[model samples]
Target: MDRKHVLITGGVGGIGVELVRLFAQAAYRVSFTYRPGEESRQRAQALLDEVGEEGMHALELDVGDRQSHARLMDTLSLPLDIVIHNAGVGTKTVERAAATYKEQDEVFFRVNTLGPLWLSEDVIPGMLARGHGKILLMSSVDGGITHFPRFRAADGMSKAAVAFLGRQLAATYACTGIDVFTVCPGATDTPMFQASTLDALSAEQRRLLEASLPGGRLIAPREIADLCFYLCRDEARILRGAVIDASLGLGVCPAVMG
Candidate 1:
């Protein structure tokens, strides 16, 4: 098949990097974003080097800056076929939120929620004009975006809002053959998982935590990536506006496996 352009935000981090690897290998012309300085740049380039730089492009971007999307629209020489909205961070903002919920709201919102919104808004219009495109919003399997419990107040609220954003956007544009998928992958083994709040627990506690899962372990990063690749295909475009969960089995872990 002919290669198409695919853009992934946060494409330097653990799961993000893996997604880059997967998409590039699948023969998509890939463009990705990174924000931190040289170290991150080095790592991303190294990964691409291992793959020989064909059908891959990486650049630094602040996804929070919606205005930049305008620049991308103007400067991009190629049409984008797939976009994976993966720029976000959470699960350890407890202390930060406690101290500055108001101040930090924009930070989290921009990176986690608005980034995708702006990207989708900018990209989908062009998609409608072309009558073909696939977009996926990378979310968490921690909870359904709607009907979030009270315990995970902030993260839940933000994710829920973004989920609605994705849903509404998909509904608005689905008629034009522009597809959108809300992707929720479970706790995948990556740097984010390594840096998780659960890391504070003892090894036994970690094992106990694993025991709570039906798989008795965390989800694999590659698993999420492969699923992402699946969703972005033209064939999977029919699944638009669907909440596709890459979770092992949430809220129903069988005791024997756990």
Candidate 2:
């Protein structure tokens, strides 16, 4: 097919859904991954129907599974022109002494950090042969730029590694027709965000938290989607290794991050 093919991980999630919609609207042949479940399948189908595009496919993926990465590559029908590593586990507050902390940490690393690394490895050979490709890693403001108190340490560590991964890939692929970019969004208004951060808060507490933000609101999924779409364009090659802070000032003002 003449249209560029893009693969997005976590396509049923808030930001992921927007990414799929935006890319499909722009005429890209999108193949997005969703976790396997009846509910997830329904959501993916809903998104596909909403997009009303012919070539968009939603495939099952377990981002934390290395074998799943290999299986996904084998399942693709076309060489990917764009890869967006967006699947991730949100922050889970756990005391260091907890028995399950180690296991949880491993899950965070496998999904948030190593998933991109493995998938990139799987796809890069084809991209190199084609002489052009774009990759965007969806990191978080907590990655390295800022730290939120009481948040899970493993989440931050994994995301920081993702930022480093993007930089490393960009450096390695520089001038080789492959571009990699990392984006760190802060307090995005997503289902994950609400469940992880806001659901526990009282009504007043929620209001206070929003009020503390730069614009009295969380970042929207569409905003991040738009920026990501632009970063994947040929013109954005100049910013190949840029670690963007899409935090809307939360990274700059850390006092309110908690």
Candidate 3:
């Protein structure tokens, strides 16, 4: 079988990085986007080196900008078979819940929600025409069944909406051979968690938080990537609209983490 074409957004985050590496190593035409950061560029270069020039490419992409998808298509110069919507934000502007939803910044909606919709919609037509495509969504467990403390209504609603959008898209494009899989990973050991406002919790509070999870440890990015790798393949074509949790069996360990 020929290698597939794949694109990943937020391609340098911990999970995104592993996705890039896994797909590139699999010999897929791997492309990822970063929003103007040296660390992102350097990491892209390193991934390219690891993949060794078979079909790895990196581009500057601001997912919030709908026009960037057009630019991405122009830059890639090929039909995409797999698209991973991995660019997102899990942060909340306010510390507590309010009576009504309020906007904090344009970025929260633009990057986390609308951007994926824009990209997926733009690519769906092409996938329909070709009768082959795979779209993966990187949502969070907090957006699914689990509850988060100090959660923003926008983030939760947006991700849940994204998942629903994927499900609807799958139903709409079922006969076209496109699979829409939503991945919900919990408390990954990424920069997002480290930089989370909850990091300010007292030592005992933090321990209690860790104790809530079954594994007693944060989920690794690679585990999520491995699942994504499987999902991106043609073999996983039946996993449409499915939400896979890669949270290290969280919410179920007896022991607590320090």
Candidate 4:
């Protein structure tokens, strides 16, 4: 049997890397996207090497760029059996007094919300033709299902739209063999999480934050990857359109952010 092909965006990122590795190990032909840059290029190459080259490929992509989305679709040789919209921008500390919110908010919406919309449009036709496909949209607790203060509102707004998008697609593709779902992860242990929320904190504050979490630690990228892998399986189609809270306990408790 031919291996199933999967395309994962932001493959150089913390969760993205784990997703790529898991899918590749499951005997899938993995095509993952990385932003075009020297650093991303090096990381992508390293991941490719680690996963072995035979069934793994890396493509340059800027999720926020429509032209990049077109270029990516044009470059694919395999019809995607699974597409994970994992690329996203992290929340920045909102500067309420500054006028920069509008500019920054545009970027959040473009990459986090619209990127998946555009790419799904391109891939869904192929999926429809084949009679089966899986799509996973990576969202977060904030704006995906719940909200926490001190973070940019745009970040949450963009992710909430992703949750809605997943449900809408699932409904549209119901019974057509296309399964769509959204995962809202909590404070995950990724560079983005560290930089956005933890890096500036003192040791005491960081410890307190960890203690507040359900597991007394950040959610591991591998945990999320495993969940995603299963969600794409044929059996998981029953969960179609579900907006899962992968947040442990943080989704219900905004106090954890303090």
For TM-score, the strongest prediction is 4
- Model 3 alpha-carbon miss at residue 2, Å: 3.2
lDDT by residue for model 1 over 140-211, one digit each (tens)?
A: 765443333423455656666677777887888767877888877665777666665466779998888777
Count of backbone collisions within predicted model 1: 0
Which 10-residue window of candidate 2 scores lowest in summed lDDT? Answer: 90-99
Residue lDDT tens for model 3, 42-87: 9777767776766778888877777776787678746889999998
Higher-scoring candidate on lDDT, 1 or 2:
2
- Candidate 2 ranges beyond 4 A from true positions: 93-99
Q: Model 4 over residues 33-111: C-alpha lDDT tens digits?
A: 9987898999999998898989889999989889999899889876889999998887652232124878778888888
Positional deviation of residue 156's Cα in model 1 after best superposition, in angstroms: 1.8
In the predicted model 4, the residue pairs found to clash are: none
Worst 10 residues of 3 by lDDT: 92-101
How many clashes show up per model? 0, 0, 2, 0
For this target, which candidate reaches the highest lDDT against the unseen true structure?
4
Off by over 4 Å in 4: 93-99
Worst 10 residues of 1 by lDDT: 143-152
Ranking by TM-score: 4, 2, 1, 3
Off by over 4 Å in 1: 68-75, 93-99, 143-152, 251-258
